[model samples]
Target: MENKYQFETERLGFRQWKEEDKIPFAKMNANTKVMKYFPNILSREQSDEFDS
Candidate 1:
């Protein structure tokens, strides 16, 4: 069956966001280098809110 949550290739896969993704997403958002172009890194609450 086709998976609505996923898109894949030979070496890579992307999927719909899940609750599990929040932690990692928050961590990535917390990175200063990554947020450098933005005004500031987002808080977990803010990230989760924006993510939805």
Candidate 2:
């Protein structure tokens, strides 16, 4: 994969989103704690749809 920009911190690397990040991104969106400010937790289907 190629990114136009890349940067490294003491313990982390930052880059643009990749296709492989979809699952983890979906999991984050589906997490109840992460969605506490919203109306409700997202279903897997909803998360998948949103990630698209």
Candidate 3:
């Protein structure tokens, strides 16, 4: 398989977001428990626009 990750460790990997990551990222942004400190849960479009 190709190594698409920017870097990896025994237990972790880091890479820029891919097109496939949007759905999961949006779901995470919409999680109340996970976003307790945020002003509000993000919509899918907002999550899609997230930078950094």
Candidate 4:
């Protein structure tokens, strides 16, 4: 039988997190404007550890 569950996107693909996404995720966290509401911008290490 074919799989019953599937996920799709228009411009991007979706999948479980992998080790490769660490850098981009960290960049987002390190961005001051993105984190303006928070007390401070996240460090690379912090961003690496943070979950979506």
Question: Each candidate: what lDDT?
Answer: 0.86, 0.76, 0.92, 0.77
lDDT per residue, candidate 2, 13-40, as tens digits? 8876777777787788788889889998
The residue-by-residue lDDT of candidate 4 on 1-52, one tens digit each, is: 9544355668765566778889888887889889889998888888876555
Q: Stretches of candidate 1 above 4 Å error? A: 5-14
lDDT of 4: 0.77
Q: Once superposed on the true structure, which residue ranges of model 3 sit more than 4 Å away at CA? A: 1-3
Using all chains and alpha carbons, the TM-scores for the candidates as numbered come to: 0.70, 0.52, 0.73, 0.59
RMSD values for the candidates in order, in angstroms, are 2.4, 3.8, 2.2, 4.3
Ranking by TM-score: 3, 1, 4, 2
lDDT of 3 by residue, 1-52 (tens): 9888999999999988889999999999999999999999999999999854
Per-model clash counts, in order, read: 0, 0, 0, 0
Supply the TM-score for candidate 3.
Answer: 0.73
Candidate 1: tens digits of C-alpha lDDT, residues 1-52 = 8876467898888877889989998998889999999999988988888657
Worst 10 residues of 2 by lDDT: 43-52
The order of the candidates by lDDT, greatest first, is: 3, 1, 4, 2
Model 4, TM vs. native: 0.59
Between prediction 1 and prediction 4, the one with superior lDDT is: 1
**Pairs with steric clashes in candidate 3:** none
Please estimate how well model 3 matches the true structure, expressed as its whole-model Cα lDDT: 0.92
